[model samples]
Target: MTNAADRIAVSTWSLHRMMGTTYPHNLDTLEVGPVTEAYGPVNESLLDIPSAIANHGINRLEIVSFHIPTRDKVYLGELKSALAAVDVTLQTLLIDAGDISDPLTSDRDTRWIASWIETANELGAERARVIAGKQKPTRDALDLSVKKLTELADGNAGSAVRLTTENWFDLLAEPGHVNFILDKLDGRVGLNGDFGNWGGPTKYADLRAIFGRAETCHAKASFVDGTLDEADYAACIEAAEAAGYKGPYTLIFDANAPHEWDGIAAEKAFIEARIG
Candidate 1:
């Protein structure tokens, strides 16, 4: 039988600061410079993450594309073996930073996403998460996103890895705009609902409008002075359930906790207590 906790996964991004020293969030496009070279020859091993999460009883992972130190097949194979050793499911490979909204850059962005899809396949990941766009949400941008995303999906036909996007960046700031693109793509792409991505008075209402379409969730909790806001966390869960969302709640622990695992454990417990 699958335990309720089994349905939960932890994203490597939750440990971004902990995994290694600071570098650009978009490590994929780093230019030749001190910041770039300092990040070169990754000091941290991606291999350690899977087993670390398994130690906390979480058996799934969503790896950020930038965190992948090397794209060499051998290194990926070793990472895949590490996950299997700990029985961790590589749920999604998050490909951050790109703008398919511009016609000038759409082709390059599409090809970049395709490359991650290939890497996701190599790592046995079930899906890859790409940023919708950093550009302002306009009709033209939406159309371009649809075109590039469709091309990416069509290009990777028959691959086991699927594609997903989050309610993130400028273009996806509003739920209506998010729905517009998802509606156009139909089911060609998936949504990875995130709690902290959108906030303010209408956050829950916005989430309610789209949670049902979520294939997975980045269950991020807000923290103030290193303490979590339970009221907001509970409401986020309520909103998702009311919207009929029934998908894995990947605990996203981004806080100033002394230990990353503590934040993860608390978030996981909070979600399980509310949902289960």
Candidate 2:
């Protein structure tokens, strides 16, 4: 049986509080400079994150595109080398930008997203998680997302990295839209199901409805008063497991809990107790 440590993955976003820097190149504004905040001075390089997380007994790392300092080949090569040094895996390159569902920007954004997918391949990541769409859920939006995403899948056919869309933004807000787009893609694009993206009483059912198709998961748990909401987190993992999901659970620690790794440990333990 896989242990909690083996099944665990960490998103760089989880450690944003400590990462201390942001590469604005991938942000919506397209600014190309580094931004260091007061909370986290520019103390660490992105290259150092692998060995840092590896020290936590977690080797699977998912990087948000925005966190990358540059697309320079030398830098990317160094990053890949760093991962190999620590025996860590680049679980996914999260292309956290673009909206292919909008008519005005569809073509441009499709090209932009494709470039990030190429970056994913260069860094030797196993997957590239792209945003499907953020436009209101309309039939036209879904159709555009399907066409553009299928094209992306085809474009990545010969590359080392795979493609996955998330249950995030507006396009995949519900199970019906999620299934419709996935059905239309016909297995060309994969799913990166997120636990906290969908809410309401139907959250668990919605997770069960689509997690069966998930290739990976964002095991995000809710927190109240800086405390881990154990019941909510347990139910989310239970729902995913019930739907036959047996993939790496990427721990997403967004809220400023007592400690980032502490929050991650709590999540890892819950998943281990549930299905690890």
Candidate 3:
């Protein structure tokens, strides 16, 4: 059985902008402050996420590297050190590799992606979150993405990092498309399920279809009138659990408000109640 503590993790992306008194790039320079004051000044570029975890009572963290500039090994090392100093471990690294529909794939983009995978492994990330981006529905483009992802996964085969793509746009967003990609790639690639990004009505069913292939998940809660739609939220979690997912429920609260944190806490409570 999965312990409740092991099954819940908060995304630093949710509070990327707030954590310390000053936006220090290294852990030694960070000035720990009250949670309320740290809510809006923490720069994602900096590595103060450990301080966020410490003050927020959250143990697991999903760090988004897209917010950080790419291919800077020195900066990546500093960030990793900061997290280590705070005793906060990374669960996954979320990245926007590039546009899947780009006709001629850019070598520069591919190099950056390879470097991103290296950095995630160095930071001790168990999985890397990638998105297929906007799709133009071309056979060549889809084939190129699959090839690139497979190569990426192979490159990191010996490491703890696994490459997982999220369903977005019209290509990988459909259940059929997800199955196709996963089956074609086999174990070389996996899914990063985002509950809010499904573009259809059967959100729960769609999630269930891809759950078997999922390596990580994002609990993206879109609020209505200061409260999440309880039914939708519950259904998503239920489908994930029913599919035998026993991983941390990573939360991504993108709403803009001081009470957004409150909403996140409430959502966490709701998920915990159901899981427990």
Candidate 4:
């Protein structure tokens, strides 16, 4: 009975173009530069997102922390109730922006990340993701990541949610450094291996190397002028499976579709057909 559909989840970031700008935290707020210039203002509310995912045949979801309009307990309860009503699992709470690499801001950023982890616990997410870093993978930066991530992980002990990081940002672009940080953490943190974050000729090789340690995957497909690259998409799946990655394929649809839901459904079908 188990198949790829059972292992699929959807990320709200995929529908960033449609998720209206009601929430205070902008997706581009933490980026190095203004990158969301092309996307339209948010058009959807968090209250409506859960049912939307369920309607698409996906029962699991990974929500970007910023997309949440409020941290009030009442709102959080509402979101939880909505998901429970439809039997959807809040798989992961993605804490999108934080740079534990900068010593000057490490204290402040780590505290911020810890705050999100607490929210993830309150929201009943199974796991939470924090960005690894934006700095180069230097010894000092890696050491700083170890210290801050350990602190954040230790705080989550005895909580239902586990902490995770992606093979994302400049510091974690390579598998060697990715392993270095994970090995140093010694299972304290998990990985959210992202297919689109890493690219180039060696992308597949890199994915295979790091995905074995992945607790989940950001199964993103590359697009050119709104067209999906089927070859690369399949290869990313193959590499992940080859490395024994058996976690949920968190579909991240970033292409141009008339309706965000249609783009998400198309991705789910693509994955199901290949893995079925």
Tens-place lDDT per residue, model 4, 1-276, is 278778989998887777754343433233223224335665666778888888878999899876776777898899999989998999999987778898877887888788888889989999999987889899999999998999998889999899999898888999999999999999999999999998898999999999999999999887766667789999999999899888889898877653667667767888888777
- Could you arrange the candidates by lDDT from highest to lowest? 2, 4, 1, 3
Name the TM-score of candidate 2. 0.95
* Candidate 2, lDDT over the whole model: 0.88
* Segments in model 3 whose C-alpha atoms lie over 4 Å from true places: 17-45, 69-74
Q: Which residue pairs show collisions in model 1?
A: none
lDDT, candidate 1, 108-187, per-residue tens:
77777777788899998999898887788989999999989998889878988888999998899989999999999999
Clashing pairs in 3: 17-42, 18-42
**With candidate 2 superimposed using the best TM-score fit, by how many Å does residue 146's alpha carbon deviate from the native?**
0.8
Best-fitting candidate, measured by TM-score?
2
Better candidate by TM-score, 2 or 3: 2
Off by over 4 Å in 4: 22-43
Best by lDDT: 2
Query: In model 3, what lDDT does residue 185 have?
Result: 86
When summed lDDT is taken over every stretch of 10 residues in candidate 3, the lowest stretch is 24-33
Residue 248 lDDT, candidate 1, scale 0-100: 90
Tell me how many clashing residue pairs each candidate has. 0, 0, 2, 5
